[model samples]
Target: MNSLLKVENLQMHYFTSKGAVRAIDDLSFELMRGETIGLVGESGCGKTSLGTSILRMPTPPGRYVSGKILVDGVDVIPLPEKEVRRNIRWQKISMVFQGAMNCLTPVYTIGRQMMETLNEHSDLSRSDAESLIAEYLGLVGLSPEIVQRYPHELSGGMKQRAVIATALFLKPEIIILDEPTTALDVIVQAQIINLLKKLKQQFSLSFIFITHDLALEAEISDRICVMYAGKIVELGSNAQIYGTQSPKHPYTERLLAATPRLFKKVEQLQFIPGTPPDLIAPPKGCRFSPRCNKAFDRCFQEEPPLIEIEPGHMSACWLHHRG
Candidate 1:
């Protein structure tokens, strides 16, 4: 069977006066129907950039250099902006942005905003739009009465659910969730996570879950893709990523080391020693070489390609491809 989404050699950069910042560099991945791929990385690793580029909504100064964002076998890259907006975006794929409060318009009632979305995307009449708004809100565990309230009227969790509801209003098959549980309290975060799992099962939705939280990613993702300095360092099934076998990429290993694990005895939680390289002037060889404890002569002089380490696991590390 064909993949639901195929991103091949995707490159997105932010053009600045100084130079182009390679936010996404030769990235490639695929999302199958009903599969959740967790994109985990430190901030500035291009996780959000990848999400936005896939949606054909890269912010100003950011533009796609080359690559294909294939949704259901159709490439969205070469399409006209109008066509992408009218057909692809929010129609086949939708995004739930990072901050719920920031994404929602504080000036408008939640209902009005959702109604406007429905109007822009479909021929749904006001009655149909309102019904959808109510149904989606309820699906996200919100009340029908929430339509009357402004964004500020809702709690953090409620605001998040509202954003989720809006994203689902179009019934998109794929959803890119960017740090969906950012600032909410622990309880609300758990609720949101559970809700996402429920919705994924109910709708058979594919998700590109972007976040810095590895533990949370483990809870929701079927596969985990580790990114560093705008490139994917490791991509593997959850068992290969978080299970007994260790990560092949050094970056992945350090990231796992840094995360605090429950029911595990640890004298000290380790941290990756160095900061990520500047995207505009990333290191000459392996982007992670500057910080990789396993870096050697080849690591400093040659960039290793992301190669399959096993049947379903891929890693970009010289150690894995020494030949």
Candidate 2:
């Protein structure tokens, strides 16, 4: 059976005045039906780029150079932009973008923005569309009356709920949630995470949850993909990733070390020393080699392929690849 989403050796880059920046280089992954995959990485590691690439809607500076983004056995890259917008985008996949609370245009009321999506995607009558929008608002614990109000009128949590409600209104198969809970209070964050879990089960949705919080990711993600520099350095189940016995990838090991374990108290928290590599002129070998503690001759001279260390665990590191 075909995966819900399959991306093979996808390469996306930005053409800057200085040079080309490989925002996403040779990235590949799969998301099965109803599976939530957490994409965890430090900032500027192309997490957002990967999200935008799914809709084939990268911003002006960046472009999808090559690869296949197959959704349920259909390749989306070859489709015309207008066709994709009319059919695939939103109707099949939607994004609750980072700062989605601010996604609503200041000029349009919540109802109007929601109506815009419903009108453009489906042929539902005006009255029917408004009813559907109201129903979704109510489902997200928001009053139907709030649709007439503007974005500024609602509180932060309310705006986020409204945004999510809008994304779900069309009932897409896949949702890319990029930092969905950033800038929210702890209580509000937990509420949103719980809501997401409930919605996924209700809709049988596949989710690509991109965030830096591995702990939070572990709570919701069935599989976790750890990114470094412009590539996926490690991919595994939550248990394999958080395993105590296995050494794991050096990058993943440091990430786990840095994560705050509320129950397992540590003497002192750790940090990944040094900085991420420059994508514009990245090193020839492993992108994380400059910062890896286990770097050796092979690490400096040759890039490691992402190899499956076990049935479902894959890591891109010379140490794991060495025979």
Candidate 3:
């Protein structure tokens, strides 16, 4: 495989005042070059944590207990913070966080912030840096004048586009976008999604798109990974996971059932019945067993491993477990 990024047995945990929370538990996956992979899960299910951990930029209280994050076959997990900041981040991989408001510093002008990032990474003159930044902003449908505006001055969609532009300015091979269109209206969401699609092709980029909506994933991703309780329950091509009548995992099916389809008549949208398991004190068996319709006695007693049940599809569940 022409893998651009590979995460192996990744475990990221947060040591809160209460207890240790496993934000990412034994997660593993790969992103092929120029591929778009969607990560979908409910809130606090490690989607954001996984995305942050990919850049090795965990906040306080969070730590990478064990894992291998490789970019272009080079292991990044062992790199020092300085090395990661200088070489790995933004240069090889970058992230546009969930909230655009949080992404940009309100006090700083967009031009100054973008220039600082550009100059820090490359030894470019002020004029050269501004020129390059403007070029990138243009790629994301922003005008050069946006550089002079503060974060508060731009519209929500514009702020998101600016953040995306900053991410792509470094020309990174992989970019992780966490709910890029979360707060925008439907029309704006479509516009941003379209912009992303165009940029990906323009730069031959690979993307990890994280969102709560599976329907959105189906619209853009070549493959989608269903995350639950800090672990991926299923991973497959969009066709195998969504196009098929039966998804290998019950959790995946329930998610699809819960999604509201436009212009499609349905009496009611099915809802997944329970709250997600507490990460600080997660169940010992399958993390998703509590909500899985196909759960059996064994499922509640032992955790399932992610194993391939089809040519390119992998799922962790008792129904597909071969042991």
Local error of candidate 2 at residue 309 (angstroms): 0.3
Candidate 2 per-residue C-alpha lDDT over 33-122 given as tens digits, one digit per residue, 9 for 90 to 100? 889999999999989999999977987699888999998888898999898978789988999999989767889899998899888788
What overall lDDT, based on C-alpha atoms, would model 1 receive against the true structure?
0.91
Clash number for each model? 0, 0, 0
* Model 2 bad stretches (over 4 Å): 245-247
Rate residue 93 of model 2 by lDDT. 94
lDDT of 3 by residue, 183-295 (tens): 99999999999999999999999999999999899888999999999999999998998784468888988998899999887998799898999999999799888887878
Estimate the TM-score for candidate 2. 0.96
Worst 10 residues of 2 by lDDT: 239-248
Q: Give one digit per residue, the lDDT tens place, for model 1 in 165-211.
A: 88887789999999999888989999999999999989989999999
RMSD of 3: 1.6
Candidates 1 and 3: which is better by lDDT? 1
Which window of ten consecutive residues has the lowest lDDT sum in model 3?
Answer: 241-250
